[model samples]
Target: MLGGGGSFRGGQDFFGRNNSNSISRSNKLIKSPFDNSNIPPFPSSTATATADQPIFRPSMDTDPDPEHSFFEPASTSPFTKSPWSSHFNSDALPSPADNTSFLPNILMGSLVREEGHIYSLAASRDLLYTGSDSKNIRVWKNHKEFSGFKSNSGLVKSIVIGGGKIFTGHQDGKVRVWKISSRDPSVHKRVGTLPTLGDYIKCSMRPSNYVEGRRRRNLWIKHFDAISSLSLSEDQAFLYSASWDKTFKVWRVSDSKCLESIEAHEDAVNTLVSSIDGMVYTGSADGSVKVWRRELQGKGTKHFFSQTLVKQECAVTALAVNDDATFVYCGSSDGVVNFWEREKSLSHGGVLRGHKLAILCLATAGHLLLSGSADMGICVWQRIASDHFCLSVLTGHTGPVKCLAVEKDNEVSEGERRWIVYSGSLDKSVKMWRVSEQPPSTFQRSPSFIPECSPTAGLLVNAPSFVIREQ
Candidate 1:
């Protein structure tokens, strides 16, 4: 339990040296928040913590209970009226030159306290899927909960929607597949599980197919630890799943066959992003980001080590590749985002300093790069030419922001582009915001320059400056 002072402790232990097998054993290692036995400690300040210290907040006599019953009837009702609305005040808008080019307003906010913390999110068309530690996946349409389903075990950690099917990665190291019924779009049926029973059986017959894991011989097709992230190929013909087991597995979308598993990192593989150019980027707890090039060999594909993009002491926690794959961004526990430009032969671009705590997730919608951090704040960055600058800092969640999903907004004029952004937090709530792709000319400003180079940051030349626009 967290103290009333809201002081954070056990900083390094959260990303400790020990590479444990199961997430449940350590309260520090990222795992299911509903474990009851191992809920990660929460801090109150939104942007107080720094890379080298723990976060602290003023004490309060009545510190709200951070833990809530997963079955709390009042907060669990999906049909309850939304407790959220736009935070944007058109009449009271700030000066464009000092703040965001245009106001990005929150469309709605829903507190699903009974379902546990939202760990992952996926947006496809008009539907939104949210996965939580309660093992339930809730489907939302038009800002209302339309339907939902549950996994018998394991917390849902990651989700991806493509090829007319939905794939969810779980803490139990299994990937579950589902499809929307043609008769009723809301009816999501479990189509199959990865490494289908038949495939598992056939592979088990050959002892040579087994790989050493968790002190036992497990099939090479299976993940022995929690599936931390999921990504899809450009054509949606293949799927990628990263896990805490230190490997990323490839699967054929059509047959759900386990195609390949690469020992990509030495520590827990936290996130993976696949690009259209046959390139895959993976971030790991080992504090390294490696690039792999995919090559077609017969009907199967093999990945070759292309290069190690950036290696540092901070664990790389999240990754995002822009729509065109022109830039790749890696977020770390040190509260900075390191980027590489594809044009510069993947040259190391300067770091973007926004959050004061670990950045847990990153998402890009057009020219905007949104980063959610453990500091309970989301920083919105807009890219102009070769530079990036902070446009806004979204604050509402009282706990660490965990995951994010964004989709294009077509309702606006064709001349202007916008996106619908969904940010999930450990505060047991999800906030939806509308963001413009381009900052208004009056609001446009270059990132503040930091002249000193950081050895860990690697060649900090002309990195984007950060200026927080108060909402």
Candidate 2:
């Protein structure tokens, strides 16, 4: 479970419930990835220090004690004997039959600390920023700890970067602004916060600026609940934040002014993304994904509800769109990934069934799509035309994968594209992987055809058009 603290809904914890169990919580007490007994000691000479005393624990390479290992001996099959189990192999230990070449190669892993699990991640250029429940944000460059800063209150939940500034949404219902110092790039300073002091005072005097929230009247410019996700507009002119308060707010980036707040869902909004086509997509615990279109109305922008892409009994936990915004993927607590295609008028694309537990986070790099699940595995899918194929499964995390960030590997050749994928997990660690866009071989194999089962209906759903190459 995400032990620190957060909001909950519908008798379900913050991460939602799968079969009435918290998806992010595991009863298993496995050895830490950084356990000294299982791994070699870190070389002090390679450890970098910063003002905040950021610690960089190396990745786990040695074998773990079997009694304390999260992975168990495999049965006859890799997947569970459930209707939802995918045909794609998911063995705790990959066998020789599985094509090792297709798998995303693990680059390294780092333990943030024993106290806080990583909640969010943002990658910009060569720098990777990680946020956690400990109220700290740490920066890494070239897989080494570079710098860090602390927040007085609230665990960092979501982070986004634009215009050389980093925006972090917190559990305290405040969005903080940070910038690197002009003289020292390693030193980060908190410059301002969303709904700044000036805006709060200006809105407080007017009764019209207050809205009923959480059984109390609060400023419409402020969120009274934890901010679950944050996104910036394609043009970087506006910032969007979705909160457990069931509303999504828009702020002008230049002046840090709240422009609009819409009650987007009946329950908490878990994820939100602003696409390049001027459309905003939000998924929530309400079990629906909604789309909105923003337009200039007078001096401010107004968001008009466009459509609801999905509505189900299971809560939608994550959302991601491809580079061109041609496809939108939604992951629900039922361990299914549903997608839609813009060319088909955003119509329902078939589900990408793989994970046996809740999918907590998702990311995209070029034609590659990555889905992180509570099952402690990452599925790498490649998009070809309108269909998707599961290339390989990357497994290592001992807890629910909480967040993901991906950037192109600039060092790769022009003809060969590779992506650097960073996955943050509730295991209090982050793992890096290198993924190739193309398959290792051109040889083709027939894909497995498994019947899809709806979470609530118990009946077979649409047959997926996706293929799972023999692994």
Q: Report the lDDT tens digits of candidate 2 across residue range 1-471.
A: 000011222223224343333221322211112111223322222113344443433232133211111112112223222211211133432232455533334333434355377778899999888887766677776655566777754668888999889998987789988888787677777888888999999899999999987569999999998788898988899999998888999999999999999999877777888888889998876678999999988877889999999888776778888879899988877778998999999999788887887777888888878888868788877777866776667775666777898888775545767787888877767766667775545323334432243221221233121223221
Residue 267 of model 1, lDDT score: 71
For model 2 the local lDDT of residue 406 reads 86
Per-residue lDDT of 370-417 in model 1, one digit per residue for the tens? Answer: 888878788877776657767666777777788889988776654677
Each candidate: what lDDT?
A: 0.69, 0.68
Question: How far in Å is the alpha carbon of 367 misplaced in model 1?
Answer: 0.5
Clashing pairs in 1: 447-465, 448-465
Off by over 4 Å in 2: 1-104, 442-471
For each candidate in turn, give its C-alpha RMSD to the true structure in angstroms.
9.7, 12.8
Distance from true location, Cα of 25 in model 2, Å: 25
Error of 1 at 454 (Å): 12
lDDT of 2: 0.68
